[model samples]
Target: MYTSDPTPTSTLLDAAQTAARLPYPLLVSELALVLADPAVQVPPRLVQPLPGGARLLIMPALDANTAITKLITFTPANAARGLATIHGDVVVFDVATGQRKLILDGPTVTARRTAAVSLLAAQRLAPNTRGPLLIVGAGVQGKAHLDAFAEGLSIKEVVIASRSAASAHALVTHAQSLGLQARVVTNADEALAGCPLVVTCTPASGVVLSTLPRSDAFIAAVGAFTPQMVELGPELCRYVADNGTLVVDTVDAEHEAGDLLQAGLDVTRLASLADVIRADAFVVNGPVLFKSCGWAGWDLAAARTALAVLPH
Candidate 1:
């Protein structure tokens, strides 16, 4: 347990070290615990606008044993600047003593935990579990999802689509290196019919994917968390809300899920991940959309996973 060891250590883990500790399977398991625990407290994240459309995110969460605050910056234009779009640290604390325990690379934690959350949703709800995973937007989040589905879902093939050819090809190479059959496509919609499992992780305010591959297709929309940004087409969002199972990572999506809100969806009427897990139910014969707006509880789960694997 996180509280068993009381001593505090200010060990600061870099991105590589952080990623080394939080593997997909372990992260996914921890996320389940976080989602189910009634004591876990995640207040609405505070967002501060920055110059040039970037923003600062402040997310804090705590349970009985541990507390964490993830401070990160979202700079949408950074990719073209050849720098990371997200940069910051996750500061962890021991709840019993009120002392700082550890620090982790914020982007690593976010990417890994977010992808793990999507993978967990897929395992429970997606009809196409093992597949030619179609990933749109070959950025950090895209790569992380590919790794997560490959390792957690045992995916054998991947098809990637992105505006940047270099980024897309690089992700495909990474997929092949992981022993998955990988290819690049000019457009994601063109590949949709063949691949049932799709992930859209771009920072677009417009639609990247507007259609479903099949009746039981699973789409994880991880990008465009703000009200002004959307990755899924409005019609597609409405179709899922009306006919299929639409799940959000948390209720925060009611205010933050751009695609759904743009489609004029009453997000409050949609089920959440916790609701789905608690009810132990899913849409049996229709499509599924997992809308992930950022939540602090996921960061707390990542902190727990890292703490568990850290050397005692």
Candidate 2:
């Protein structure tokens, strides 16, 4: 059977082009559908250690009609070298004919999809949707999350904090460019109580969020994926588990989620993003903490959406 192809020549989309194809709203829609699809298969990601404290990641996922693999290298030291920390490409293929269909910039897909996942969790779990959103970490993921919340949630105000003044102000400028009232704070913890919707995207080796959020707060901790890295304080994580709902993006998080793992949380007992979405009746009691570990299924879903936006 001939497969319908979106990129006959395997057209390669750069960062900007790929970002253009997968807007937050479209990516969120696709994520909700793909996450609930029983036919989708996401294999565990392979993390191989490279020399000099670098890592090579191999992620693959597929569905009835499409297949994708994202190969990327992660080096924490890249920051010291004044270079990007993550770099790679997402290659898309057709299932029926086993032919290459398209290629997308890997880092773009990673940043956008990661932020989109957090946005999805916020949409379902956040107690307050209106007012100022607090964002920690002023990197690529921080920018992507800002755009997602601003565009998808129609959030009109933002407060940003980062280790670097230049980076934080730059993100503040970006937020205002989107017509959102934006400012910078010196401390994320100090800014937490005022903003009920919060996203932590730092790559901290220790707990970045120690303060307990307000009862109406919704927190998406997307910073630390490895057991060696953690962004949520142990006490705060335990508080959420006892007093509120603790959610994860995928089951893989049980082993990979540094925030929950370091927080001494029972990762296996917590509900997931899919679980909340499928629940017939859901109610929020206290703060909601959504921990996200990387998953290839998200990349596969993003590939489908990115391809659909491409001309046949």
Candidate 3:
């Protein structure tokens, strides 16, 4: 029974406040329901190249009562110039009534949902995870992950690593400012050395962390969604398929995941987080990895959470 206004109502601060209030377990359960619900259909993203270090990605999600469309633009050029790398808006419409209910700030929504996705995945996938938590990439996603994860788990140590040592140092400073045990590391090897759970938020187009020093750890690769971007190499996929569980947001998306596809990896058993959450898990004796290409269901879940917390 909602109608679209002449002007969209949601703002960044509004979304942020809502995001902060949405409990981690609630977000996780909502995402699980969205994925497992047969009425929801979220297809693979359709991406388009753009000019000046920008790319356009379109994502669509469907449920029994609603349809969501998101158009996102990534412009590293803009980011370098102190602009948001991602900028866009989200449209939510009632499937039954065909009434557009709301339009929201896409960047804030994306950041919150994506971080929530990572934390949820880590909660389900990683075990005995006391840290020395290592985070690769200190970009927006990386920062968001740290912020969200801190809200959900107890962290004793945090190692921030990036290609730019300065960026790593900055993140270390930020973490310390928040009273976290944190420091900067050099590269993947150093970051993965003793960390029990590592999250990569880099936007590398090729393999960033291929193989780890040991199999006693956990990883959540949060970057890379296209047919050419991957934060880890094929070794990680092979390891996951052989010794651990490899749950993806979607199978079709992983098939197009540049690292796995290029490495001739056949990820035949791609289970959604919903499936994993609902099913009984097997005991694992080695490192477990979860890869995410980002999913539209997460956006809808985050949007709903934002709506619940924003002032009416």
Best by TM-score: 1
- Tell me the tens digit of each residue's lDDT in model 1 across 1-312: 345367657889999999988988888989888888888999889999999999999999999999999999999989889899999999999888888988999999999999999999899889878788999999999999999999988679999999989999999999999999999999788898888799999987578998654777899999979899999998888887777888999999999999889989999988888877777455455888899998999999999999989653
- Residue 137: error of model 1 in Å? 0.8
lDDT of 2 by residue, 154-228 (tens): 688999988878889999999988999999999889999899999999866666679998999999998888887
**Using alpha carbons, what is the TM-score of model 3?**
0.87
TM-score for predicted model 1 compared with the true structure: 0.97
Please list the residue runs of candidate 3 whose C-alpha ends up more than 4 Å from where it truly belongs after superposition. Answer: 1-25, 282-285, 310-312
Ranking by TM-score: 1, 2, 3
lDDT score, candidate 3: 0.71
Model 3 error, position 127 (Å): 2.2
TM-scores of the models, in the order given: 0.97, 0.96, 0.87
What value does the lDDT take at residue 278 in candidate 2?
A: 87
